[model samples]
Target: MLRTAAAAILGVTVLASASMAQDYRLNPIYQTISLRGGFTPDPYVINLQSGGNNDASRTLGGSCRGWVATAPDVRLHFQAGSLPLIISANSSTDTTLVVNGPDGRWYCNDDGGNGLNPSLRWNSPMSGQYDIWIGTYGSSRNANAQLHISELYSQ
Candidate 1:
């Protein structure tokens, strides 16, 4: 009887360990293109016509807008490519960038040059379509920038 009880307890421990393990896998690739015309008048620009020197770090120094889709319990991988063009923003107000989602409402805010980048990662809290809005404004106006993006869906 003692031996049988010990064996039963060992089996239960093994089963519990297996159930507690977490599994992470790569999801399929989803991608799209986004652009901002240099000639268009952007309300987010702080200095419309001021052509200032381009920052070498090229880090987003001003506010810009964009969106991403969301789904309950879903993780997404965002990859961005190099941008060769010059982009700028004004100093008066934060640049306005809007991110539109399918189920959820739009997300708009001033990003003091924090949005410009090679890539970004986002997770979905509610499943639905999403879009990113780029606000053009500030002394960074007329500055050109280009970037390619890739998204990997993961659960």
Candidate 2:
């Protein structure tokens, strides 16, 4: 009986961890965009809803604030050059940004953009895939937000 109970507990713990794991390999919740340095559109914009059930600090760690979904919000395939790369989010409610860079590093920011938005800038960014997640501060409630990808300046 003791062995059976321990097995059941272990099974439940494994299942829960698997569900909370964030998989960048999976298709993003929004859309995937391929952009090269100096792409025609200066700032590529995508409208999305922010916040999720997963706790960013718990899942991502290292000052990763806010709540985000299990899957990425957007995936960006960037070809780098001389120019810089900027990712920002704009919303009425406070929002946060979490990115898994191509270099296999986690970058996060909160209120680094205009007003209560979040932004991240990479000078001389590497050329590869960037998985992005937009989150809401304080709570798990979703909020309307616009994600801006630009090489120029943040919005």
Candidate 3:
């Protein structure tokens, strides 16, 4: 019985230390729902108009962007692993977004075409969970943007 208690305490200590070693603080996602982006190359749009529009910092992985938001603002699963992982937001509102890939890399985009919406793509990333976010092109509290993910392939 004593040995078991000691082991439990050790496990807690290890976990605490490991979590403290992260270079980027992935804020707790109190609100989020993970789902497939379908099994095609079509873009699936999710409503993030009610998302949180505030992040402690705008510079993720050493890249700066607009109003940065963390999970709950956006969180997705890249099940379909083909080509590149595409993340885009509504262009009309100047909404920027980023992807904190499973491989400890930060991917952000300010604009990808049509208008001021931001889009980012990860080339052949390892299949896993990713933390998605929605931000602005500069710094604003506008949380009125729609988010979309495309180029996904599912089995």
Candidate 4:
């Protein structure tokens, strides 16, 4: 009976750890912001660090790259309209961008922004939560970065 109980505990622990690995279902590390198309002051900027232990390419699949945390850096509850939604990262270190769109699709970018930064745009974006993850390109190390969310331009 003791062995069975210990096995059950071990199983639960493993399951919990597995679930936490690069799971977008978790809450963001920063904060949640609500915005509508044409409601921003052009760009909504957020200061944050990029990179984490989880491998973005393996966890997020597709063309995703870089290393990212389990939880998102920021979550954007966006109400879309005629304008496009642009998400970008600006950092001295080479950085990557990963977004889980409201439509349950994953978007990733590398060097789409100015210099070595990353950016992704959704023209006619969906209205819901956008889980944004900013990551370093080379390895799993946090680096200073500014996340720019805009309807007009990217940086």
- Candidate number of the best TM-score: 2
Per-residue lDDT tens digits for candidate 1, residues 58-146, read 22222223221121112222222232111222233333333333434433333323333212222222333334323333443433332
- The alpha-carbon deviation from the true structure for residue 31 of candidate 3, after best TM-score superposition, in angstroms, is 6.3
Ordered list by TM-score, greatest first = 2, 4, 3, 1
Candidate 4 residue pairs in backbone clash: none
The true-versus-predicted C-alpha distance at residue 30 of model 1, in Å, is: 16
Candidate 4 lDDT score at position 88: 86
lDDT of 1: 0.26
Every candidate's CA RMSD: 21.5, 13.2, 14.0, 13.9
Q: Stretches of candidate 3 above 4 Å error?
A: 1-41, 50-58, 70-72, 152-155
In order, what lDDT does every prediction score? 0.26, 0.79, 0.50, 0.77
Candidate 3 backbone collisions, by pair: 66-136, 67-136, 80-153
What TM-score should be assigned to candidate 2? Answer: 0.85
TM-score, one value per model: 0.27, 0.85, 0.63, 0.84
Please give the clash total of every predicted structure, in order.
Answer: 36, 0, 3, 0
lDDT of 2 by residue, 1-155 (tens): 01222321221111112224567778999999999999877789999999988887788665677889889999999999797788889899999888888877777778767767777777768999998999999899999999999888776
Native-to-model Cα distance after best TM-score fit, residue 79 in candidate 1, in Å: 15
- lDDT over C-alpha atoms for residue 43 of model 3: 64
Worst 10 residues of 2 by lDDT: 8-17
Stretches of candidate 1 exceeding 4 Å from the true structure: 1-95, 112-125, 138-142, 146-155
Better model by lDDT: candidate 3 vs candidate 4? 4
